[model samples]
Target chain A: MRVYHFSEQPYHGAWEADAPSLRVTLPNKHCDPKVAADLINWRLDEWQLCDELGLNIACNEHHSSATCLSASVNMPIAMMAGRTQRARIMASGYAIAQRPDPIRLAEEIAYIDVATRGRLDVGFVKGAPYEISPTNANPVKITERFWDANDLILKALTHQDGPFSWESEWYHFRQVNIWPRPYQQPRPSVFVTGGSPGTAKSSGANGHGFINILSGWNARTLFDMHRLASLEAGHGVTPWSKFVYTALMGVGETREEGHRRLMDIAGYFRTTSKVGEAFMNPPGYMDVAGNVRWLKANQTRGRAGNHFQAAKRDGEKLAIGSGVGTGLGVSAQDMADAAIAFCGTPDDVYEQMTEFISHAGGVGNFVIMAQGGEMPHHEACANLELFSKEVLPRLEEFDQSQIHADTEERVLSQRDEG
Target chain B: MQTATMTVDHVGIDVVRAGSGRPLVFLHSVGGVDRDGAFLQGLADRGSLTAPWHPGFGHSELPGEYRSVGDLALFYLDFLEQEGFEEVVLVGVSFGAWLAAEIAVRDAHRLAKLVMISPVGIKVGDRETRDIEDVFAMSQDELTEAAYAEPERRKRDYSTMSDEDLTALARSRESYAFFGWQPYMHNPTLRRWLHRIKQPVLVIGGTDDGLLRSGYLEGFVESLPNARLSRIANAGHYPEVEQPQAVLDLIDSFLEEE
Candidate 1:
């Protein structure tokens, strides 16, 4: 499996003049396009560094709050065009349906693809309720918008000369001729965010990739659902390459250290619940009615609010959380040990990652969460260095042979069965 | 009546007292309010008004140590208790509204009636939430266009302002660091604690607010036990500026009711 390092630059420091940090905090709203640009540059620099270190792709997300400065994924895609040639620029997603003109999105993607020389992995999303409000698009229609926009973007980017007319409940367009076609012939590889059965089905039917933000354990079920969807959609046992991608944070000197780091990140989210919620859950963005309806409908499912929350809880309980705190839950070493979970001696992390990868069905691309919460720059750089030295080389070697064999076997078996 | 320009915790907070009645405290929003700022004027025109600069806004000495919204809330609570305002009405607008909600949750008995206008704490679904990061990216013209309804009113040249006035605005934005440094302009659990507010709350939101939608007001009303909602038409996020009379009327109606 190809390991792609994902760095989310969460700019952390005191908001006041007295606060000290490498980056200066400009006096502006978090959602301003300029701040988004600055953050994109910072993250791209990190990504470029990772590419130099032999990582596959650099990743970031679009969100309104503190967790992410890039509210619109398009900005990063545009910015990363000239930065790096080798590493794929992954816009984890832009809430495609949220924009008024999907055609404009098509044009932008085409422009970026041409500029980047075919190194773009586009992630389409329906967007969380919080991020959706800024677009002024109806929340309920977001799913429909995503599908329509995806179809249009794909058609516009791939098809050469013909009037492309689309008639849908939400969108209506005729004679769509997108200028400056993408560098990749069939358009850049498409990846959809979310782990729902519906998303899996859409990914499979469309012959795109599926990215699951869930924990490793729940990821199995997601992959299973994707496969089932592919089978149902007549794809018939497709290779894992076109199926599943998992995003996670890794750090370790030993197995224990890796677990501790994951826990610390989780703990940061847990203790700073208000901060996370404030950053993640902006007002008038998500479908409050839908969320309330879903909660009421699935109240029997216990405390799980939605799929995202469910995955987080499951991931935290199984690996993410357990890695941070020890059995007793209250100990200085335990808290201190948490840092080691995400930041440790390199060899130990490789082992922890290998075990996670194996359990996670040997994921195609392991998107490493390089930045989160208030993790310092030096710490992030240190983690990256250790990961490169200790873990990446081993993974690269294993992937070269393991992935090739797995693909060959799977393909041969499918052909024989057919 | 006594007026003192004392520094509390190195924060030059102004204290205003009038009449032998119940103590009412007011926390102004971003820009410093003069006698014309209806909310401050209305309260002072009615009863005792203890209007403080909130460390970074008005004539107050900006505290070097303050950071994070919780710190501001805690400081205000301490400010009230220190000033011997046993029972008080806490009125906050915009950022101050969030502070008011937080204060009520933290210590409800100290507050009599909590008033928040265009308060932002909970995530309101389907409204255009202003991206603080994005706002910072704009030029002064763009900032004014985004922030105020009357863009013409914003001074073309801030350079012309007196050193003190300029410093105050800068300091206010800097103090904004305490409340809005990280995660932009929100405290996640503040919404969770809305239910904890025992005191009556009057939430006023602009009907035409592009930033925050009407549903936010409804959510606020639903969340708080003794909360009422009032919508101001033709008003943006800052209704106190856009529809001052309507806001004052709502406050009057809310306070007059049993």
Candidate 2:
């Protein structure tokens, strides 16, 4: 099984005047940038530690936010390209539409792809309004701009003629040819981030892939849509290979440790301001706006007379109470019973992931949010080590036989039902 | 109160007067009110003050077609001449600073002194300028962090605020865009016209300003023939709020010298 670890540099410490160190308020500790950088370097080192560990690691883009330091995704991608010779570099997605000139994005992506020798997975996105709006560009036009830019970029990358000519309402280009064609034939594997069916359909039709970040009931709905879209597109239906990626936050040496990690991350979300909530939770997608409206509509139905209570009944199930309970050292099964929560030791995480695979038919790829929400650097490193050593082995075994068999069985069942 | 009558695009221009002594006109910033005339009141407390809200701002009725900062300045100049307030002291902040500078450039004889705080007009290549995109992307805390020296104090508890209050805040902030839009902070011609403005000018800068760095203030002061720079430490883009006493002291000393 191919495993990709996602690292989000959670700003977990207080600003130090004397040194570049963050004094974390909770779990009460000092996390220096040096320590954080070491943790990152070690994570990269582990790739060489195992033959099964693919060179592919993921980083993201953000700006002037406390949570992450990689405001420019290119910085990390460039670093990874320079360091690794074999593994693929996947920027989970960059906010390409934010730039006025798409050519800059095309040039950078092509450069990285060429340097990496074809091992590149480019994930495209419109990005959050918090990032897009500040650039004087309308957030409402993000989807349109992304598609237009992508079309131009793809044409520019693959075309060999003296130049390319294209005209769109938003963008017009004459003689657009990007130099140093990618090492990968045609281009790098393109993926789009979305949590809804419409996004899945578009990705499938465009010959691109979909990386889903939804969980619980929504995951089931999204996966089903992706499968149908693949089938309808006449791209032979295979439950395991169809473009689908699932993300989960993992931690723990024991099942208890895993539960605690999940809780710790969840607590981070609860207290943080919803200031950039527009970025994390965009409207219209997953009926987010409708959920907000529903909560407002049913304010009287709440027991505690708070927005949270109203939200529980109307909005997508937020993992607040379960996260708190799990962090407090609650039993895994007990925490699981509280809600459709995902947390536990490496083994527990593997089992839960497998269950999700079964529910969605069969899993093809797993992307773990290995670092998130004020998770300390050392703790993140330890979690990665535990996961690599303990969980990956079991997952690799499942990939060998059970996962394939499960996929076959699921297809057969569907055929029989039809 | 002395009032002036000047017609621009068939609309009446009212210049209200308060206090009495040295003639000084108060130019309201992008979102400020002319009726309340806080700047004029403050100026009037010291001496004579004339306040007028630019067209399309506050209660001012928009003329048939008002365009460009220059048109607004011309209209203000006519009002000043009609009111017989020659060689008057002009005070402006933000976008108002742009209009005041524009007016001074057109006729330096009309303005004896000028004070521009966190002004917007000239573009300096060395400094990283904040565009509309940068402003909108900032969180309330981020915006306040960039705009004020003591951001923690200005950070409001919106949780307890009523929806009406939230709506009002949003509306007020949006209205600020009316004056600051178009070519954004730079007018291209503003820098070239700076040397033409012979009036004694004081440029106030906030050291901690994230939008425009202190280096920008130096460039601004250097552009003007008769200009001096005064900085407020531990202050952001809006030093008037963060270091009000410092701003007051600097203004007082500068005015006394003039």
How much RMSD separates candidate 2 from the native structure?
A: 10.5
Q: Write the per-residue lDDT of candidate 1 for residues B1-258, one digit (tens) a residue.
A: 344576666566755554446677877776655445665666766567777777655557655455556777888878877777876878788788888887788887777788888787665453355423233333344445555566576434543555555555545554553356345567766677888997888888776565554366787788899888877886767777877778778877777776
* Model 2 Cα lDDT, one tens digit per residue, A108-189: 8888988888867888776643454335554433566778888888877778776777888557778677878877878887
Stretches of model 1 off by over 4 angstroms after superposition: A14-41, A252-344, A399-418, B1-258
TM-score of each: 0.52, 0.55
Error of 1 at A357 (Å): 2.9
Q: Give interface RMSD, every candidate, in order.
A: 20.2, 8.6
User: Best by DockQ, which number?
Assistant: 2
